[model samples]
Target: MDHREIIQILNEKKKICLLIDASKYATILTNDSFKFEECLRIISKLTSDLRIINKILNKKSPKDKITSLTNILLQLYGCMLALTNGDVSQENSNDKNNIESNSIKFVKGKYGKPLLESSMPIKFSMTTDKLFSSMFLTKGLEDTEVGIDVANVINYCGSNCIDLFRDIFTEQEFNYLSTSPNATTELQKARLFTKYWSFKESYSKYTGEGLNCAFQKVNFGELTIEDDTTIKTYDLHDDIGLVLNFYSKWIDSNRVLTVCYKCSNDHKDNYIVHKRIDLRDVLNYLNGADIFD
Candidate 1:
């Protein structure tokens, strides 16, 4: 479905898809015809918040600044579309650059988890790898937070990958990656390592720990595979009152995607709905075209 349809679903259900593509963004950034200043101007208009615009502009590299701006633009635009019930005419109106300043505020958790300062109960998490970026946004989930991560195992399948990860994994997790019967082949071990690492990262993000939480301390030794759909739940030793429900899948043979969120203490099933957003459509919308119309 198109972004308009997805925004409608987000407005009604408070959950949208897992965004999993960034090639379009890379192309636009790398294309010789693409004007960096022009792209920056569009991002400024879309966000309309000097705080965010200045943050993106202060990055060291042009690519870094543009990429940061683009990602934040997508997030702010998505939140705006949902909050305004898809009435985005202001996005293209003469005062578009003031939209965010007038309507919304962006905040962050203590550990840098981005949050939208809104009356509605909305939580979003985003992560980016080399080729793709993933975002999870949902609304009206009382007392629950979400975190997402994507990793490419192929990059870690090098000769010293096991050695590289030796310090990151706990003893049991190391055994699982190095000598467990479940991971006999080199590629198998790499995939297993990716899963463990992504789980730790997403969990930390969920807790607003960011990189402060030591990966070695977060052990997944007791992690067990569930019966269906590769869904798994792990109880955090650090917090007895919260449960981590993870929905993980292989977007491809070499790439793994994970979404982590909290569930009730009783272990109720909470499944996340995922849809891939079209980067081209997002690009078009950023250019002041109403894809919904």
Candidate 2:
């Protein structure tokens, strides 16, 4: 969506979503002159958090780490800028009226969920998988909590997914996967696993625990697989929270998306709405970053 459209959507929807295609930077990442330290420094300017800077530096692979990080930085930069002002280009623009982009930061919470390192009542979560990542930002009202997650279907299914699922899901969940309407074949079960994994990840994010450790412990509570990909109902135990709403879709057969959010039970079903978006402003702005330096 365009900048104005995003602003309108956030103003109306109370939530902003961004999906970033990070493949364009792979070549630059491979270049010999690409400086990991410097590129992170640039991202840090946007994040303004040493936790974000130090956390990303701890990644095992330099190229993979930086590219994954760029996804978060670029998406966060765009949404935050767009929400604050209609134009993102003005960060470096000659026009004096254009406000400089605010100094933002990304730091993990106690549960490993990414949180905005600011006093402002804003909550956001980010997820990265291979060449893609998503960000969801919401108004952190006192009564509601927001969390989102994205998963790679093909990648998850490529591994020993059955065993992995056994370890990650509850016994009932494993039983459901074993007898799902579309689980006659191994591939179907793998895709089924994707939905569960994505949801659990999102749930943990919403609770600010990042799956509360391996997702096996965070129960999704009686989810039924409608067919192959769609989860019929994503219910949480009443003891966990007052009200929970889920928004999920398959970006494609190979990728599954999910957003699990909680709000005060007093609010109706429409309280926090999520809309998938590819904010063009974010990409355009990150394209000029000097990662190759």
Candidate 3:
């Protein structure tokens, strides 16, 4: 299948792949969102590192948001399996022993972002709305961190969300979200929310701090929600802002996905050369690859 072909290419070129399925996770966890987050909490309980659970506790975020992030973490664990270890299901178990084995271990960075301690140089970021979950993983990235976020253009991301997420945007950005012409129709407003929210989250995860960063200080500059592709040239919160860029696309009527990357003048051209692979390919490779890590 195309997935197998893409995996071969990525493996050769040292590229990355993003995997997303808005509904499968809820199905995997038996449609109980709270149950999944609780499962994550229990696994976090097993880790000697309390940072995973502690960061979630500090967010004081809503149950749904917490659940979404937990799902992404689990999915990211699968990505690691697909890349480094093969035949993931063969070792399936949710017990304490399997917790560390089924999922990859992440140690907290100085700022509380889960830093990958594995030998492979992969960086990932994940985002989830009340309805969907998405993850991004990159291989061959040498010292740079990558972030990603996916949001349903509808759902809880409509005009009604502006006030709820107001604190996350800078003054200029809040004005755009509140007053832009694109903010008129219900669908437009939803698109607006998804656009900024996804980029904000991508930046947050790119920095490895998640929502713990000073989000309001980060600036995405002037942007329209209707842009068709990724927008480069975003800036961080500093007086002398660091270079950041976001690439975005509406994969379907219901979903919009964005990826963030940090590139210096030397590597910018090389990093943007990215590939989007079907999640099915990763699954197929996991099931069929004769060589296991």
lDDT of 3 by residue, 227-286 (tens): 544347665536545777677776667667778876545344433333443333433333
Worst 10 residues of 1 by lDDT: 88-97
Task: Put down candidate 1 lDDT per residue, 203-232, tens digits, no spaces.
Answer: 777877877766676666744322127446
Steric clash pairs (candidate 3): 230-247, 230-248
Winner on lDDT between 1 and 3 is: 1
Q: Which stretches of candidate 3 lie over 4 Å from their true place?
A: 1-4, 8-14, 22-105, 129-132, 155-160, 227-231, 237-241, 266-293
lDDT of each: 0.65, 0.59, 0.58
Ranking by lDDT: 1, 2, 3
- TM-score between model 3 and native: 0.64
Q: State the lDDT of candidate 2 residue by residue for 225-281, as single tens digits.
A: 332242233444544433566767666667777776664443334323334443234
